[model samples]
Target chain A: MMWLFLVTDALLFAGFLGGYAFCRLASDKPWPDRTQVFDLTFITLMTFALITSSTTMASAVLAARNGRLQAARGFLLVTALIGLGFLGMQAVEWSHFIHAGARMDSNPWGVPGFSSYFFLITGFHGTHVLIGVVVLLLTTLRSLQRSNADELVEVVGLYWHFVDLVWVFVFGCYYLV
Target chain B: MSSQSGVSSYRTYWIGWLVLLILTVGMVFSGAKPVLVGGMLAKASIITLLYMHLMHERRRLVWTILLGIFLTSAVLVVLSVPDGMAM
Candidate 1:
């Protein structure tokens, strides 16, 4: 059921990307240069944090499955911390963009869709990260009290990894392309 | 997928992480659209297969998930891009 949900969620993102393509390709005005607007160094750091958290989550799952409850809980705690850090970095990015006069309807960039889609796509993904962090913390707390089900750890790991997967495309299409 | 001991499992995840990082760096350096798209796909595959353990699933389930999303997404992109360019 979890896998099925992920597939559907992924399809939803696929639609978003498709629409992003339409808006970008169809626009007469040039899309804003991402390099001018974004701090690539910070974005790269965000990516590193996410990917590392994913590895931690995976390790947590393995440790849980192997009956190392304490180790699993430790890994989960680290993953949650990293996830929170990623969200903090995203907040900084959003703050920088807003201070530069970007908004839902308009931005300093000539192409309105650029900022619109930027916020829409990244905002949606950021919300997922936030939710994942909350879930990880809750799970860690539960496991700290007593060992939780192994499947539960695996399922949460799946969601965390899926979030990372979506960011790969967002980073590629929005920032790199 | 064969059962990996705890050490090897952690090692596998880190290896996957390394590959993803390398791909990300390459994409950052290569601004070409094709290279970016290709790198993005590769990273997604690695996350799905290795980190998510999709490779451990039965063949039928794997095909269903991959094809369902991949084909539909491809169609959406293929149709959207050209029509958009023609606009």
Candidate 2:
């Protein structure tokens, strides 16, 4: 079930990104230079935070499989915390852009699509991270009480890793290129 | 099959994490080069194979996922080429 959802979701994101590429290629107007607008250092930290969360989530799954419920819970809690930190950084970046007069339709930059795509794509990805954090929290609680929670952790870990994987593309699209 | 028995060790996870971080830093410094795309692909592959345990999964399941990804990429390429030409 999760695999089905993930593959479909991946296709959805690919479509969005492909549309973005088309718009950029077909438009006569110049695209905004993302490097100048975005803070690479800050986004780099956010990427690190999310990637670390992936590692922690993997650790949690491994620990749960090993029947170390306490360690599993601990790792899940850490993963959730790192995810929250990523969200916090995203909020800061968004607020900075908004404060600088960047909007979905209007911005200092002439290209409206830049802000729109940035918000739409990153916002979509951020929502996934937010949901993953909530699910991680619930799974952490479940791990505390359930004797056989390893499979549950593994399932959730897949979702978390998928989210991380999507961010890899997002980072490349929005930030690097 | 208790999924745990064949699971990777903490050392492996840490090493994968290190490699991912290094690739990320390389991307940041490399800017908009074509190699950065390759770097991102490498990062994604490492995460999918090592961290996600796709490498250890059944060959049929792995191939199915790969086929889906390939189809998606092919669609993106096919769509983008016409758009680029129209430009």
- Cα RMSD of all models vs. native, in order, equals 2.0, 1.6
Interface C-alpha RMSD after superposing true interface residues, each candidate, one decimal: 1.8, 1.5
lDDT of 2 at A170: 91
On a 0 to 100 scale, what is the lDDT of residue A175 in model 1?
81
TM-score of 2: 0.95
Models 1 onward score TM values of 0.95, 0.95
Clash statistics: count for each candidate:
0, 0
* Model 1 residue B61 CA deviation in Å: 0.9
| Model 1 lDDT per residue over A1-177, tens place | 888888888988888889999999999998888888898978988998998999999999898888888899999999999999999999999999999999888988888888889888999999999999999998888744554457778888889999999999888888878
Q: On a 0 to 1 TM-score scale, where does candidate 1 land against the true structure?
A: 0.95
Worst 10 residues of 1 chain A by lDDT: A142-151
Tell me the spans in candidate 2 whose CA falls farther than 4 Å from its real position: B1-5
